[model samples]
Target: MVQVKLFDCEHEQDLEEEINRFLSDLEHKQVVDIKYNIAALREAEDEQIYCFSAMVMYIK
Candidate 1:
């Protein structure tokens, strides 16, 4: 069977760390693919926000 896990955070490091921690608890060979995405938005003239996300696909 195939399973999907999603991770999201405002900081890239946080997102990376979360994903790493999750994958570490699983067998490496079971991981099939990892897709990463990012989005940027302007909340004001002088401020910007960033969103980092990842999708992990694996065999369970």
Candidate 2:
């Protein structure tokens, strides 16, 4: 079986933390693959905010 999870946050650190917590809960499962995507949410003068999404595939 395969499982997937998505996580996004205003800050990259927050997103990473959320992903970590989610993966931790699946420790009993064997992970087959993991993937992620990141994109800018809005345009700014010189900086931009980011959003992230992650997918986890595992065997049950």
Candidate 3:
């Protein structure tokens, strides 16, 4: 069956690390694709918050 896993982080590197770790623990054949997205939101006049996320599509 097809399944999806979501991973989110404030930093891109951290998100990559987490996804890599999880991918390494699973068989490569199980993973179909990965979608990555980034967005920035204004928290204040001079502050911004960044969101890094990934969607892992795999076969369960």
TM-scores, all models, native as reference: 0.93, 0.67, 0.92
Q: 1 or 2: which has the higher TM-score? A: 1
In candidate 3, list every pair of residues with a backbone clash: none
Worst 10 residues of 3 by lDDT: 40-49
lDDT of each: 0.96, 0.73, 0.94
Candidates, ranked, lDDT: 1, 3, 2
lDDT of 1 by residue, 1-60 (tens): 999999989999999899999999999899999999999998977699999999999999
Query: What is residue 58's positional error in candidate 1, in angstroms?
Result: 0.7
lDDT of 3 by residue, 1-60 (tens): 999999999998999899999898779899999999999999868799999999999998
Top model number, TM-score? 1
Residues 1-60 of candidate 2: C-alpha lDDT, one tens digit per residue: 666655667777887888778778776547777788888756767677777777777776
Select the stronger candidate by lDDT from 1 and 2: 1
